[model samples]
Target: MPAVTADTLTLPRLPDLPQTATAWRPVREVVRAREFLEGEGFRVRRPFPGVGLANADPFLLLDHMGAVEYGPGEAKGAPWHPHRGFETVTYMIDGALEHRDSAGGGGLITDGGTQWMTAGSGVLHSELPPQDVVARGGLFHGVQLWVNLPRAEKWTPPRYQDIAARDTTLLSSGDGGALVRLVAGDVAGFRGPGATRTPITYLHATLSPGARLDLPWPEDFTAMVYVLAGRGTVGPERRPLDEGHLAVLGRGGALTAHAATPWDVLVLGGLPLNEPVARYGPFVMNTRAEIIQAIEDHQAGRLGRTQVPHVTAADEELS
Candidate 1:
């Protein structure tokens, strides 16, 4: 399959239907993200295990860190870490995150940008605030998602997809009241820029007051929506959802949400990987044995060495 690139990709048409039936999936549960300090004292809210992992197969974890303004020298993002058997996606919403890894992969993901790093075999990396952000002080907000790789593809070569804010696919609702940004899936007629090993759909949407979106979704995929801001109603039942809450959707033909106020939400879903999962810290493998191997490899310096080079203005400006 071809990689989702800037020039090679085209917008797909929205699925046509005979009727506008709102077969929205009902919200199964509303859960809150567990707050914790991770990666050199950076605060984060995790919403997965707190809710339930079985409903979120292929997606192991989600860490939402800050929409808060940081004082000078206050930001302490993730330091050196190791990962394998899955992919880590960093989506920046407010500040800049400078990343450097053992596999010679490094970049600066600024506001509205993303860095999709596939830690297939193994890799050591760090995600931290840039010097400018730390020195000058600014708002810091972002989400880090762990995407599980099938057992057969766990050892694939690692790679990176750095997508700038401008390069992402942005689509508007029919009435132009709702804006949808496609990062890694098909939304309406638009497809995201990142290619994936597993079939998944990830969307970031913002709706004006009274705006609504009825999204066509695959029935077989497990879907959920996380509210980032404002208030909204979801599914055929129009279950009310508030900020900082995650709503798991049941099986349905489509996923829908209507904004009661200006609302911001993230939609994520993927085909389930019905396999045993053994996870330890950053490593996720099929069995405890594989997890042990990953740890041993890192301790023995097999993952690779960390390389931190200064990010130039030109490098940070890449789209």
Candidate 2:
């Protein structure tokens, strides 16, 4: 494991404020996860970039994979591909995903694990189910989030952080009805393991019936929550949100969510890039010329090559 220093692990803290009554942000819009196909025929529910909702500032896309059971040999995950000018975050909920990249990095993101990859400049990679899981066939569930990079760091060298479930910072409510797993960024004083160029917080929370959670957040960040299971109420008005619904929050210093039933939600917030976003399939850049250059680079083998040609990068040992 790599040593984690304060500089690498902690995000800059916003100025502290006098203790005041928690004010919940209102729900700006409620969007449902829409089904889509991506990464070599894998099915997903994309809540953002759908009909009603567009890009959410620093967050470019989010794909919620199945809680469905896959029969033996039925799973087909993302195949070999290239990415640039952004980072890819994969959070595993119930199954295993094997990952390999052109830079000689590879690992397995099992249940409760997360793989954070910075496809700065460019990199070739693939994510797929391990053979054992494919043969035995079991529950498969996860989410993939794309975090856009600022122009200044868009061409930084690629890197990877494979975080095991045990590495995540877990916090529980006083009554024990709510639990939060902080994967990246700072929340309630706990910092996650992954380091990000963009200041952001990514968390997964579970709320038991009748439970309420009040989490402080940076006022300037764009915040949103996606309910993975059950129904819940969010914000000061306690707007009702059913399963598969995503709630985009308005400006506030805190977020409040109450569970009508047991609920699982993914919470994400980030400081906006406030720059132009130019995207061509798999490549996100600040300009169309940069997008064209990325494509040309991939075609010309400028992105590093993987050792295993037929199997993508999954079979290579992590460097």
Which candidate number would show the highest lDDT if scored against the true structure? 2
Q: Runs in model 1 with CA error above 4 Å?
A: 1-22, 51-55, 305-319
TM-score of every model versus the real structure: 0.89, 0.89
Weakest 10 consecutive residues of candidate 1 by summed lDDT: 1-10
Model 2 scores worst on lDDT over the 10 consecutive residues at 1-10
lDDT of 2 by residue, 1-319 (tens): 1111122123333223333566668999999989998876778999988677887989999999988789998877888899999999999988889998876677888888888888888889999999999898988989999999999999888877777787776776544567777888987677877777899999888878997777789999999999988899998888999888999999988888889998889999999999999999899999999999999999999985533222112222232
Reference-based lDDT, residue 109, model 2? 84
Clashing pairs in 2: none
In candidate 2, stretches whose alpha carbon ends up further than 4 angstroms from where it belongs are 1-20, 305-319
lDDT (CA) for every model shown?
0.80, 0.82
